[model samples]
Target: MYQYDGFDQEFVRQRSAQFRDQVKRRLSGALSEAEFKPLRLMNGVYLELHAYLLRVAIPYGTLSSQQLKRLAMIGRKWDRGYGHFTTRQNIQFNWPKLEDIPDMLDSLAEVEMHAIQTSGACIRNVTADQFSGVAKDEIEDPRPWAEIIRQWSSLHPEFTFLPRKFKVSITGSSEDRAAIKVHDIGLALKKNDHGDIGFEVMVGGGQGRTPMLAQTIRDFLPKSEILPYLEAIMRVYNQFGRRDNKYKARIKILVHETGIEKLRSLVEAEYEALRASFIDLPQAEVSRIQNFFTAPPYQNLEDQEALLNQQAQQNTGFGQWLQANRTGHKQPGYAVVTISLKPIGGIPGDISSDQMDYVADLSERYGFGEIRVTHEQNLVLPDIRQDQLFDLYQDLVSQGLATANAGLISDIISCPGMDYCALATARSIPIAQALSRRFEDITSQQNIGPLKIKISGCINACGHHHVGHIGILGLERKGEEHYQLSLGGHAGFEASIGKIVGPSFKEHQIVDAVETVVQTYLDLRTEDEIFLDTYRRLGDTPFKEALYAAA
Candidate 1:
């Protein structure tokens, strides 16, 4: 992880001091609540339902062991004994006193972390694949670029107060674990014919009251022009994006309203005119940032295929876990391990302070002394030794983190919903819980194959329901909670927005509807076809027909 430089240290210090004074003024009655609301929001403090929620950005979801320990300490000393990991790969504190926010910021700054840009209508945390550095298919680690964006967008005078919030996600892998297609700006790293690494920029993708897949603004942009290109896109949106109506404000809306070709032209015009004037990013600066993420050294250990096979023969549970949680790594013998936070009936991404400390310790003991938060709302011990997999698995099991459902149907990604969110219309956690409980059988879940069941309390799509294989959007109908199902949405290499199947279902019927879809897929799939493949091949006709069938 990147250590904070002098400039970084000073910036955070000054900001914290300024915010401390701001808090004092607000408490002393000099700054009224009305005047203080925006200031607090800009500092990443929000007056959420029931209490104040402070969202702290874990940039690119990479954190050092010390940082993790600091988080554990924060959770232990303050508000709640746990923190909620969000789909954007950030962490949130559900209960923080309003008066103590400045002190909280100071503590975060001690670890080179902060709440800046985690809230309000500005560029939010830059997210990326959880296994950015270790993914076997990655052309290059995306964190250096993500860090650059963090510094560039931090308190940017031009964009700090935009019409609406903006989010950017990047991925260096071919598999697209970062869900780049569903973000305001998505960057996919690629190598052209000449074998030079760069990015394929996707613009105008988002999910909210309206959802639209991003379109390629540039098929390939050289590494040097990334910042300039991003500036161009932001400039275009800030100038012309709708401000009169909040619903029509995202870059996605503007792209749809003006047509992608026109939007592309406008961004290009901005790029051409402003590229020269933009600050020249130093190569050494990028290299300095890259130094923080250089791959760790590993001994040339022999592959453990035979040992793993023997263990699998001895324990079916271990075999199931290996199949679900283990992922290929670029190194010869290490594996990327996803510790599922979504245990049956447990909160989607809430990890207790003790669990956080344990995870941090485990990362140092078995994996690298580093951790990552995925867009799916899971944590990753990205550089685990292959030989120690079983021990690590056992440790995780003790904490109920060993769910063995990484990409399986039971491992659903859901938001806080009506339980904690002020904007929610229905309860998402209970629905997620019911569905996961229904699919508790690992064999059945694996038999059903790779399925993403994402749920959101509202159209904001915080849970990324718009891209799930089976998307569930909760809504209220006539004072009763209901869920509308969407089928065939994908957030992989071939990204597509999920479409609503038909009418919404009652809260009780929603889980049944999901089961119906799964059973329908099991029957309809030809052979080894996942839910997504089957849905795309046959379209929604079969599934929709099956879903609405009388029980």
Candidate 2:
């Protein structure tokens, strides 16, 4: 993990001091609510349904055990006893008092974390794949580039206020686990035929009221030119992106209205002019940032396959967990383990202070002293030794953190809908909870196989509902909550937006509707086909017919 230098540390501390004075003035009636709105948003504070919400950035979803403990302590001291991990790889404290937030910011600064750029219409937190350096199929780690972008974009005077919020993601593997295609700017690191590394840059991908996949603005950009090229893209968007309507302000809308070809020409012209400017980062600076992400020391050990196999044979529970929650690691004798935050009928990403403390302890004890937050709303111990799996699993089970459902139907991604969000229309947590209970049987879930169910409370797409294998959107209709279902959506390579099946259902009928959709896939799928593949081959006819016929 990247430790904060003196510059970074001092920067955060000064920001905290500034915000503390602002908060004091607001409390003393020197600043009205309207006057304080933008100031509070710049510091990542939001007025939610019942109380203020504070979102803290977890850069590229990387956290040290020490940082994790501080977060747990802050949650315990200031607000409720738990915090919600969000889809953007950030954490939200939903019940903080207005007067206590400055203290929270100071506490976070002590741990090298902050709430800046988490809200308002500026560049948000830069996210990358959770399995970045450790995944077996990785080409290179993307976190270095993400960190470079983070340094460049933080409160840049030129882009302090854009037409709408922008997002950027990077991935270094052939498999796109970061959902790069759905971001405002997506970078896939690749090597050319000459064996030199560069980036495949895509722009204008987002999901809200309008869903669109990013288009390839540049087939290949040299690694040295990433920052300058990004500046060019931003310049183009700022000049042409809509400012009259918030609904049409995202870059995705601009790309749609202007067409990809014309947009590419405009961006290319800007890039040519900016190629000789100071925005082009030097290679030495890039290497300086890359040094922070070098691999941790590892002991040479043989693969623990024999011991793992024996343990699985001895315990059925261990066998199920190995099947569902474990993934292959780049190094032999090591494994990546996903700690399921979504226990059956539990909130998708809520972790209590006690649980966070325990996970932090285990990270130091059993694995490297590092933790990762996934876009799927789960925590990861990224470098667990295979020989110590049994002991870790035992302790995790004791803490109510061991649910052997990582990619199954029970591992749902849901937003804080009407329960906490002021912009939501319906309750997303209950719908997700009901669906989890409906599929609680382990055997049935394994049978269904590799399904993603993403639910959003409204059309803001905070839950990433547009990319799930089975997407559910909750809408308000005539004073009642109605749910709509969509199919064939996915977030990996060749990302596609889901298509709606038909009419909306009442709240009580959604679980059954999802079951019908799953059953239809099971009936129509060929050998070893997943839900998305089956839907693509057969189209929506079968699932739609089954859903409507039963209704």
Candidate 3:
């Protein structure tokens, strides 16, 4: 994890102080609600359905033990005793009083964390692969680049107010864990034939009322020129992106309205013009940032294949968790462990303060003293030794964190819905809870295999429903809550938007409707075919027939 230097510390303190005064002014009646709106948003505060929501950025999803402990402390002291991890790799505290947020910001500053850029129409938190440095298939670690972008983009005067909010995601692995295709700017780190590292740049991917996968703008851009290239893209968007309507203000809309070829040419022209003037970080600073993400000290030990096999055979729960939650690591004796936040009938990403402290301790004891927040709303211990898997699993089980359902139907990604967000049309958490309970049987989920069910309360797509294998969107029809389903959406190397299956279902009928789709897949699928593969192979005809004909 990147440690904050004096300058970083000073900058955060100043921002916190400024926001403290701003909050005071608002509370004192010196500013009206309308006046305070933009000010509060700039500091990552939102006036939600019931209370103020404070969103804290976890840049590139990296956190040290100390930072995690501080977050736990903040949750315990200020708002409720829990925080909600979000799809953007951020954390949201939903019940904080307006007056207490300043203190909360000050507390976060003590741990080199802040709420900056977590909201507003500015560049938001930069996200990366949860297993960035440890993934076996990584060409190079992307964290250094992510950190570089964080420093460069934070409070950049030119991009502080763009046409709309922008997001950037990066991944170093051949497998697309970071969902790069759905970001405003997606960077894939790869090496060319000569073995020199660079980025494959894609632009205009997003999900909302309109969903589109990003298109590649540059096949190969030298790693050193990334900053200037990004600047060029932002300049183009800032100049020409729609500003009249908020719905069409995103860069994705600009790319849609202006053809990709024309946009690419404009960006190229801008890049050429800025090539002489744009000052990039020097090699020394780049190396300094890279040093922060070097691999932790690892011991050379044999793999624990035999021991793990023996233990899995002894306990079915352990066996299931081992198969689902563990991922391959670059080190011989290490594994990346994902702690699933979505337990059976539980909220998808809510973690209590105690659980946060427990995870911080486990990170230090079982692996490196670092934790990673995944885009899927899960926590990861990136450097856990393979030999200690059972012990860690037992600890996670005791804390109700070992849900053995990663990448399965039960491991749902859902937004807060009407429960928290004022923008939501219907309840999302209940839908997720019902779905999890519906498929509570571990055997059934495993049989289904590698299914992602993402649910969003509304078309804003906060839950990333557009990319789920089975996507659920909740909408209010007439006076009742209704849910719509989309099938075959994927957020991977072959990313594509899901298609609506049929007319929406009533709230009570949603669970049964989803079950019908699943059963249809199970009945028609060939050997070893997952829901997505079968759907792709045979389109949406069979699933539609099963869902509507039965209705």
Using lDDT, give the best candidate's number: 3
User: Each prediction's TM-score against the native?
Assistant: 0.98, 0.98, 0.99
> lDDT (CA) for every model shown?
0.89, 0.92, 0.94
- List where candidate 1 sits over 4 angstroms from the true fold: none
Best-fitting candidate, measured by TM-score?
Answer: 3
Give the alpha carbon lDDT tens digit for every residue of 439-534 in model 2. Answer: 998778988999999999999999999999999999999999999898888997689999999999999999999999998888998999988899
For residues 3-50, write the lDDT of model 3, one tens digit per residue: 889999999999999999999999999999999998899888999999
Off by over 4 Å in 2: none
User: What lDDT would candidate 3 get against the real structure?
Assistant: 0.94
How much lDDT does candidate 2 score? 0.92
Error of 1 at 142 (Å): 0.9
Q: Which ten residues in a row have the lowest lDDT in candidate 3?
A: 542-551
lDDT of 1 by residue, 1-551 (tens): 78888999999989989989999999999999999999988888888789989989999999877888888888888877999899999899989898878888899999999988888889999999888989988888999999998999999889987888999999998889888888889999899999999999998889887888889999999988999899999989999999999999988999899998999999999999997799968999988888988878787877788888888889888899999999998888888999998887777888999999999999999866899988888888989888899889889889888988999998889999999999999999999999989888899888988999999999888998988989999998889998999988888768888889999999978988899888888988998899998888899888778877664
Q: Record all residue pairs in model 2 with backbone atoms less than 3 Å apart, i.e. clashing.
A: none
* Residue ranges of candidate 3 with Cα displaced over 4 Å: none
